[model samples]
Target: MTDVAVPPPAPTTQTRARAEVAVAGVRVAPPVRRQAGAGPSDDGHVRLDGRGAALPLDPSSPFEVVDGRLLRDGDDVGLEVEAVDRPRFYDLATADGVPYEQLARLHGTDVLASTVIQTCIRYGEDDRCRFCAIESSLRAGATTRVKTPPQLAEVAEAAVRLDGVRQVVLTTGTTATPDRGARYLARCVAAIRRAVPGLPVQVQCEPPDDLAVLSELSMVGATSIGIHVESLDDEVRRRWMPGKAHVPLDDYWRAWDAAVRTFGRNQVSTYLLVGLGEDPDELVAGASELVARGVYPFVVPFRPLVGTLAADHPAPDPAVLAEVTERVAAVLRAAGMRGADQGAGCAACGACSVLSTAGG
Candidate 1:
């Protein structure tokens, strides 16, 4: 067996517990659970100490929730665990009978999110991101292949009316067109904004060939944008996200710069997942550059979900995750950038990552 690298110790007990539970998971089952889809995949939504947290429910884990507190080995871990109640909007359906749940689902407590296009061009085995299950939910019939702008608008209006959804997140599968699905996302953003004026909405997509689409999204009412690059290391990208790696880091840099210019500093974000064989120190440095360039590097641990190429891979060491998160959080703090300041999207929601807990 390969010797596991021992990560540096966590900065605090809370950080250590958060990191341990992030990978080992907890035994409690949350009411709102996300199985597999465009990810931060395979987790249950709950509030950890009154803050949103998406944690995996691994039966074998030592952690459990009792008396509204997180416990491990029969001792309180100083963390509260409250399952997010299922939203009222989930009960409604469209006029044509498509269930509202099929359109969009609640993330954390109030963030409504959907993958507008449930399929992707790079979903083929060889080119797929090793950690992505972007199409598995589609194949399982949990969601539709494509969601029209009106359908999304109708759902968004009801979600806001019935459940008081605070924000919306719209992401899509990478398409073959030059816009790479940004144009379609723009149209969806316009429809949702038209339906619920001033509701914060965040749109996520690949770096499009046309940077103009970035401005178009902002003009139409996107509160923020996430051009997720999962990893900044070239080798890690090529090995884990072969198809996306083809876009080149320069493309991501250009898109991030354009997005920052359009959406304003700290309004633009990207995913910087821990693990995936990236050098932890280098990863933190890259995140520093991103923060300096006005990009929020939303750091998250890599979960090995059920329906992905890396399903069998182990999660990063808790100590390593916590150490990395603490370091990245320092950089974000130094730059006066925090995920909640983004107003919408994953960072604002702050469930999938422990960065918020680290004060990022």
Candidate 2:
């Protein structure tokens, strides 16, 4: 298939600025910073044009947030920027005395997110995903090893009551169980649903040996699910995520199909990390394929986070990242799959990726 080019949008638009900030990050220190954990972008959470954006807080970047506007080289860039205030829920603690902040942290402005299990079985140097720092926050004592269901329920209730958190994201490190941690996520989802009644929650994990676990999560009121396969290229998967690569692309496809059936179309999403050495055309083609299968392919840039194997790796060129986002976003728009319609999750939150900015 001949790949059609999606011309880069004009640089004067906020889409261009959003792409730049997503990759290059910004220079100012925001009130809520995600220094490291569970995912690729360790960033400062802010509202860019009143939408959530997780941008790297790099002291060296040319972009800076000044007085509610994004400035480039000390000049206004025509985009609004503001810090996301630390949530009121962070001030409270459980009866057992675990700080609510340690249990679940606010993502963007109102999304409550937690790594239910902090330690992944693939933590050994040889097996770790080069782009992931899932355990870094745990080792740094920023979060707990395991968040109990009741504890999560308590935190969920407080976040909703104290801060009006609209959605919750529950992600876990890959466990040894056949369900690969989905069952525990289901338990957490059930407990949180009971606590908040109609709150939307999204559960994320690796593809489980038992696909039934997907249905189990859905039955418990999980509004969405992320079965994140960072790269679709087998060679890139092996090179970047050696341990998770062993699961095979077929397993991921099966799980995604099952999830789309259970969670419904756009509710099933995956992370496609740019700059993992996958060909840009191939990456865009893979994203189009995902959309065809009723999955939302969340396109995000690769961040070389501290403590990960790829810590020193350079980020993808902003141009390349922007083009990929634009192309995939065109596919999403054609399929009528806006991330917001996913109900809840990373895609729904739209903080870490530029797809939302591109009208995905």
Misplaced by over 4 Å in model 1 are 1-10
Off by over 4 Å in 2: 1-12
Give each model's whole-structure lDDT.
Answer: 0.90, 0.90
1-360: candidate 2 lDDT, tens digit per residue: 224454544433667778888888998778888867889978999999989999997889999877899998988979898789888989999988899999999998889999999999998899999988888889899999999999999999999998889999999999999999999999999999999999999999999999998888989999999999999999999999999999989999999999999989899999999999999888988888889899999999999899899999999988888778888888899999999898899999999999888899
TM-score, prediction 1: 0.97
User: Pairs clashing in candidate 1?
Assistant: none
Over 1-360, each residue of candidate 1 has an lDDT whose tens digit, in order, gives 112233333568888889888888988688888889988579899999999899997999999999898999899989988889988888999899999898899998889999999999999988999999989999898999999999999999998998889999999999999999999999999999999999999999999998998889988999999999999889999999998998989999999999999999999999999988999988887888888899999999999999999999988998889999988888788789999998799999999998888889
TM-score of 2: 0.97
